[model samples]
Target: MERTYSVLVFGNEENDIMLILKFTDQKFQSLSDFLNSEVHNFYTHIQKELEAVVTGQKEESDFGGNMLNIDIGKEETEVYYQMDDESLGEPCFISTDELYKLVLEWKEMEEKMRRGEDIFPVILED
Candidate 1:
């Protein structure tokens, strides 16, 4: 069965942003486990990257423009950055609280899926 989870992306020019990050069941479990341990490290990395940008210690060329892209799959996990527009500034650093909330949301979704609920479904209208 197709398995996927999505998170609402912030720090963009347009609102109501959603990023549907696809992952296999195994990979999703792995990510859930990793988040339990390394979420802080993830947050730290983003903070350092933003700090470097502000201080000019690192050139913008060193990293992708702004939006942080995280792709996870059965084979591997990848994280990178991209700019939505020239008007959009640097990616917003996710605060610890926000990260925690995201983790909670992910876990809740997982649980709901495990219960065989339709987490996302297409609605047909006649």
Candidate 2:
């Protein structure tokens, strides 16, 4: 199956734009005001961890905490996301190859935004 990832812009007012990330059936959202904030850090951290897994620094590892947890494996990676405070949502598995590409795409989008490039409604399918 081809997995789809999208970045969408929302909100009614110019000052209220929100960034929405759609990954298959899941949606993660953030205020545009914080577009260059903590979320980027999380993505970068995950990217590094994924790289470590790819480079054989560790047999397996995990990234994220609290609302999200990614179990990184050699071939497959499990992504778990939760919006609620007390429970975790169902886990989804994607190939580590695809996850690496997705994270790189996200980091590229962030860089574009930082450079004042328009990146709304971006779609990545793999």
Candidate 3:
């Protein structure tokens, strides 16, 4: 089955920080599964690079050299990324620390949801 996903980047350039939130297609078995897998993939990739930097095998500056590339289904996926010109850096340049924080926040939200907590507030439609 084909699945869709969304990658949202939220932050300001003045602070040079961005938070990335990836939502898995609801068509999947469970949100937990999807989130777990996605987080695992990200962790694996980042861990490798982090280890390299720790071991002096790679330069710290090269850690987040590549742009954030997420694969989404053609018809089902949607992406939202916006940045003000005043922001100092591009979305592609989000730091590893920010990415790590995003993952942590994602996991925390998932846990809260599992406990039957509502993470999103109700929105009134016009």
CA lDDT of each prediction against the hidden true structure: 0.39, 0.57, 0.36
Write the number of the candidate with greater TM-score, choosing between 1 and 3: 3
Candidate 1 per-residue C-alpha lDDT over 42-66 given as tens digits, one digit per residue, 9 for 90 to 100: 5455444434544456443222223
In model 1, the clashing pairs are none
Check candidate 3 and list the clashing pairs: 13-87, 13-88
Estimated TM-score for each candidate: 0.28, 0.65, 0.32
Q: Lowest summed-lDDT stretch of 10 residues in model 1?
A: 59-68
Off by over 4 Å in 1: 1-92, 121-126
88-113, model 2: which lDDT tens digit per residue?
33556777776677677666765664
Off by over 4 Å in 2: 1-19, 24-39, 82-89
Candidate 3 structure quality by residue, lDDT tens digits, 1-126? 222222223464433322233334332232223234545356556445434544556545222213233222212221112223323222232234433444455555544444545434322111
As for lDDT, the candidate ahead, 1 or 3, is 1
Could you tell me the TM-score of candidate 2?
Answer: 0.65
Compared with the true structure, the alpha-carbon lDDT of candidate 1 equals 0.39
